[model samples]
Target: MNLTIDEIQDFKGKYPKQIWSLFFSEMWERFCFYGMRGMLVFFMISQLNFHEKEANLQYGATQAFVYAFTFVGGLFADKILGFRKSLFWGGLLMIVGSLILATNPHDFFFLGIAFTVVGTGFFKPNISSMVGQLYKPNDSRADAGFSLFYAGINLGALLGGYLCIAIGKGEIFSSIISESMRWNVAFGLAAFVMVISLINFVFTQRSLGTIGLQPGHPESELQSAPMPKWKEYGVYILSLIFIPIIMKMVSVPEYTDYFMLTVGPLTLIYLFYEMSKVTAAERKKLWAALVFILFSILFWGIYEQSGGSLSIFAAKNLNKDLLGLDPNGVNNSGGAFFIIFLAPLLGLLWIWMSKRKIEPNTIIKFGLGFIFLGLGYYVLFATRLFADLQGITSLNFFTIALLVITLGELCLSPIGLSIMTKLSTKNLQGMMMGMWFLASAYGQYVAGIIGASLVSTNENASNYDALITYTEGYKQLAIYAIIAGVVLILISPLVKKLMQGVK
Candidate 1:
């Protein structure tokens, strides 16, 4: 799968120019995605009258499906329609889903969520696969390229988060609309972003050249004909059938857990099957990829709380005033702004380190990710002592914790994207990319369980009660992160050997 010599020689700048198109497309897609995400739990608790635990469970179920479906979507892209077609189809479904939510906020919330889950399944993994496709095998720019893409995602997140709060709080829609109608405005904005993303991709996709074209079966008898229409339509019908099932799963926590339990082992079996087919060296690389994937579940389980527990804590406990903006919106924007400023520097740093042969290997980078995650939680944990001693949530301490977590994210997230492409065999690229997000699916499910456990049932609980709950959660998560980081570092040498020459 290595790019031919001319393609490799074409890397003349910090990034391939086509990445900007992908960047803006993903940015808007993320704008739509996170715009809804930033407000989901708040919307549930406020408008839908959901208890905190119920909200957490529901959030977990939805996020899990959003990611878990990527595996199915990836298979569709790899085996039937190619990446470009999948992305377009997925985008259309998402737009429809977002509009559904905006149009009937009370009646169709879960239904809207279902459309998004299926739509994202097809869209998210393949866009990432396309980013990897833009490079040749062993391309040094690959990690940096993914970092830039990751930054674009967060940039959308920052803007989307701001819009979510602005509209939700009646800051923008207050003049012409009542407070009750403001949320609809936010959801409508999310749909609008997706529309823009689809339009942009339609125009710029030719820049991708032949990267995602489908292949004909090599058998001479079948090579000339296209895939049968019924088969393609049958897959579409099968995918549609899952929407109701996922909608049901998200409505109940136990069902969601059971779904992941069933999916996790089946996915592992697929990986094992693939490993059996590869040569020994390639098998080792895949094993290393699995090791990272396993630990990533833990990393993401802790990291994903920002959308669930952490967001609640910010809205309830933290100082919200940042120049009259909603605190949750500001908090949500903080990490994205950090990513925008830091990503290019980090991307360039990777390039510089690659040139000097001093870049940290993937295992070590993952370990760093864990360490920072641990540190971020520990920082938040320390706020509990401050709350006990001074009765303050300490906005400064909360902001600092976010910054630390963003550092951990920088180390791991994009690196995961880069290494998956490097380690996977070309034919299995989409499947493996989906598997990577499947780890996130599991992580998000675990996050829900953890967040739900911390819900305060008492409506009038004092600040101390909330403090105790958050502190205990932060302390426990911090300890797990540190343990995972230490263990990964301990095994880095062996993992490095397994990586076989991949950096």
Candidate 2:
């Protein structure tokens, strides 16, 4: 497996060219995704009239579905359809979904979220695989390439966060605009960004056409024929049965609890089924992947609060105004803006470390991720103390906390899938990747529930509930984050051992 320069040379492209194309493409995709995400919790709790528990449940359910669909999307790309086709289908679906979202802010709102969940399922994973395809195995830069792609994710987040919230919430322009017009403008702008991302990939697919297997692999003895139309159609029909069940769960945010109950046993069944067929080393790899999977979930459960409870804290409590401009609507999406700058530096940081053979092992990196997460939460708790002690609040307090947490995120989130890809065997790659995303499904679900608990008042969000929970929930979350990090760090050696030689 020692990748000599000659082997690596075969896959090399113009690094700058490939990086730029991927960067811009991912930037827009993230913009659309995070733009909606930035507003989701606020929209659900404040605008939707949902009680804290219900809103949180819905938030978790929605995000869970988003990650869960990647399994279906990945199956399509790996088997019947090609990556280009899958990306097109996914992007087109998102555009349609985004449009539906903008059409009206009323009853169909649920429909819009449903469409987005399905659309993201289609889009997220495959495009990422394509970025990895950009580099050859021996090229030492694979991690950096993945990191670059991740930066694109946050770039889009920053744009969406700032622009969408500004337009949707209208603190900057509320005096000059109407709510519906502003909101629609924000949504429409996101749709436009999606279209552009789709366009970039569509035109450029021919260049990397050799990367994804089904496209480049000859139709031969090695290639499996497409599933019969009947079988494909049958799976589609089975999927239809779940649609009603999901719709039925709309009344209960705790539906994810049911999903966990069922998926757990089913997951065990599938693991055994796969393990029965795999070689010993492959089995070890799968088990290793499973170990990382457990830690990964804990990481995201705390990390994803950015979209849930953190957003609310920023909205109702954080002092947004820094230099005297009114800060009311600014907090909604500003974290994304920070990601735009920080993500790339992190990406480059990985590249530099990899070049020097100094990058931390996967488990250690993840351990550090937890540590930073703890520190980030501690920063929040400290900031709360600072606010309470001073009786005067500044946006800087929240900004300081966010900066710390984001740096912690740099240590962990971006590299997770890359770890799974490296550590798992070939056949289980798709399944393990699917599982990785599914972990996020559960994490977001849990985060939503946790976020909802912090939301406080059912009747009015303004101050009545603020008096009840306010900063207390954040204080508690900070403590939870710190403890999780310390525990993960302690177990890092055990987890790293499970990884075998994959690192």
Candidate 3:
């Protein structure tokens, strides 16, 4: 029953059986992740009594740390724990964190968030790296595999995004669960699913064969180890030790800013140090990957408004009835809903285009993603024009905007993951994946700042004032997105050269 790495990667058909296992594992993990994400700003504003701007900053800081830790997690996985152990450890932490939040979200909010942040850092990047390992280098089916994997991620997001916020807001289970107990139930749901994710991995990881084994461990002799057991134990101990530090930084937005500023530069310096050792071709590909990373930060900064400013906007200025559902739930889940349906179709489209030798290169796809992103934000801005006298906008317009944003995300995110693996050497795969998610951390950090700037400083500002402010900010974002798209397209040729035929 045990398949070697070659046997697994060389399997017939569109995907390896192991992909399904990873898929389910990632699905439940994403449910936990997006569920917690959907609740953060809402919880801060309503329960923690944070102002809108302050909540935005805190949300950004928390999400940023969650992603930034991914780089650290990836490094540890690359150097010590390997993907399998890293994922298990991360899942355990996430379950504990969710339980902490469920115990008393209002009292222990920052502590719970800090644990989840660290947990996510370990869980997020390594699994995706493992998926990359399932495919041989330059395997044409890799994109499709990633695309399918992306759908599983969105499936989880759709469920958790809708359910968690809906439950926490008392929109669902109002009869059985009192308002006092709703938030607890929501947090509890995340923990429960995390347990499922970890258990799924535990039972199915054998299918992965040698794919996630620790660095320097040969596939032929799985028991042989180049690294010391003490080093592996050290990683676990250090991660736990850093939890309090993470808790402190996330609690104070200013401290997050300091951490962000220092961490990014230090990561770059370290990457360059590694780059000095790679071949010229690999270095060029790494440069191409860097370009993608840089652009992604901008893309996510604009796209991630859904969690911060857009969440608040849905609460304050959007119509509550979209088929009798809460607008906040719709805002949180809408993109994922669309992606679940769209990712496969897009993947097929890419395959079709490739057969004709006319597939747009990854750079062009990245550019197009930004263009769609711009259009999506423009639609969001236009919602202000449709506002009723009460300043509440149509949910239809909101849904349409989500669809457009989903299109943009489909173009960039999955492709970005696929390309990161394609571009990095085997030894650097985990690091490059970490860097990609770290870019998202920067994006999340910037999104918070942008969201905060748009929020009215006056505590008594009306919904109409909020609509005006947020729409104008969205308009600015649309313009920037369009400009970035155009610039990326213009420079695509240069980037293509740097890719060195990675398409």
Candidate 4:
């Protein structure tokens, strides 16, 4: 018995009650996730004694798997475990990973990283797919719903960013905890919040009814027959074998490059295979989705620098303090701050525009995002011209650059999530969401490559050299993004036609 899409959306208000449950669950999960993200590279550099290029490579590899695994995780959820079960297992794995970090990050860093990556693969895509399941196809509220969900993600990021930094650098916990143990404490807090997320979801998930119920559930029909038990176990076993392979890739930057070259073509082949099974209209929509996915790689490849080169730039080039806080902590908070203040307004703006039938189509919105991305980087490129003899520039320049990027993110991210759900067929929703993350995986990998190029091994390198390298990279990226955006704008009408009337 398939539940009607409208029945799935049957709630009085603009949002269903279950959305709050999912919201809070995702919120705490993100708190744990982003808290760790905010501090990862710094931890590698400060605690693990990794060089800038080394840390960037490791960061890129780790993030790459964290997303790439989503493709597998989503497939498993759609076929065998169902979304709810996958979510729980993934959340549990993440909790274990976080606890391992808290116990000892240095000795168990690789193990902890492995666990979180696998956990995120299972948890991330399934949770997002469930969010899409809450609404009917093309629900007018879909974009706004995703915006609010995006806000929840940032809310957790805000708290996580601030809390982890406070634990690491602030004096509030200094009396009870020593500075040496601060990073551990921060990780412990992330674990604590994850526990809260798991518990909350376990209790409140009934409100979601049949939304993500898997195995014999109607939504499960979207996928093919589940593999034999032996085959399923074999897949998991084969995946586990890759852990060591990934460890090796993280150790060597060249391996990471090779891995991307391999995965990029494989991803395209997989997309075409899935498209082969769908109707022409759905295939066209998938093509549109691919266009957005392609541009997204460019957008995220640069945007993710907040954790890579830009992070190093802030630490080495910018002033030590920002508003009386650690510059790294303050820098990490930019995304959250922008989302907290701007997400609601954007949400309302989308709904308002939609009501009047004047909302920008998805392709146009993607182009707009690229334009902002270009402007953001170009802003930094301009600041390079103002560098003094020592190559130090105003902190405001960095802040403004980040702020502009946040604008680009707000345009692209939530909208990307919404459009992926809308454009994908019901059966392939989870897989497509994973594909979205896969594109992000490419972006993160390329970002690391780009970051690696900026690293000067002189150890005594001059600030001017670093400034020159960073700004030059930013200039090239700005030009690339703006040109891509303009080209997308030109083809948007064609892309919109390919969308087959999906709004």
Q: Highest TM-score: which candidate?
A: 3
Candidate 4: the clashing residue pairs are none
In the order shown, the candidates' Cα RMSDs to the true structure are 2.9, 4.0, 1.4, 2.7
Instruction: Please write out the lDDT profile of model 4 over residues 1-503, one tens digit for every residue.
Output: 34544666876666666677798999998898788877778888978899889889878877777777888788877766778878888888788889999999889887777777888888899888888888887788888888888887788888887678667664357899987798789988998999999999898665666667766654543445544667556645665665566556656767767878898898789889989999998999999999888889888888888888877876776764346555676677777878878877888898899999999988888888889899999998887876787877656667787788788788889899989999999878888988999889888888887788778767787898888888888889899989988998899999999999888
Off by over 4 Å in 2: 1-19, 137-139, 173-176, 213-222, 226-251, 323-332, 386-392, 457-470
Candidate 2: minimum summed lDDT over ten consecutive residues — where? 1-10
lDDT of each: 0.83, 0.66, 0.92, 0.81
Candidate 1 lDDT (Cα, 0 to 1): 0.83
Q: Write the per-residue lDDT of candidate 1 for residues 301-404, one digit (tens) a residue.
A: 89988888877887777764345566677666778878988888898999999899999888998999999999999998887765643234766778788889
lDDT by residue (248-321, candidate 2, tens digit) is: 45436666678767885686688779788977866776776777777777777777777776666666555545
Of the pair 2 and 4, which is ahead by lDDT?
Answer: 4
Off by over 4 Å in 1: 1-9, 217-225, 385-392, 457-460
Using lDDT as the measure, name the better of candidate 3 and candidate 4: 3
- Considering every candidate listed, which one attains the maximal lDDT? 3
Q: TM-score, each model?
A: 0.94, 0.87, 0.98, 0.92
- TM-score-based ranking: 3, 1, 4, 2
Worst 10 residues of 3 by lDDT: 216-225
Off by over 4 Å in 3: 216-225
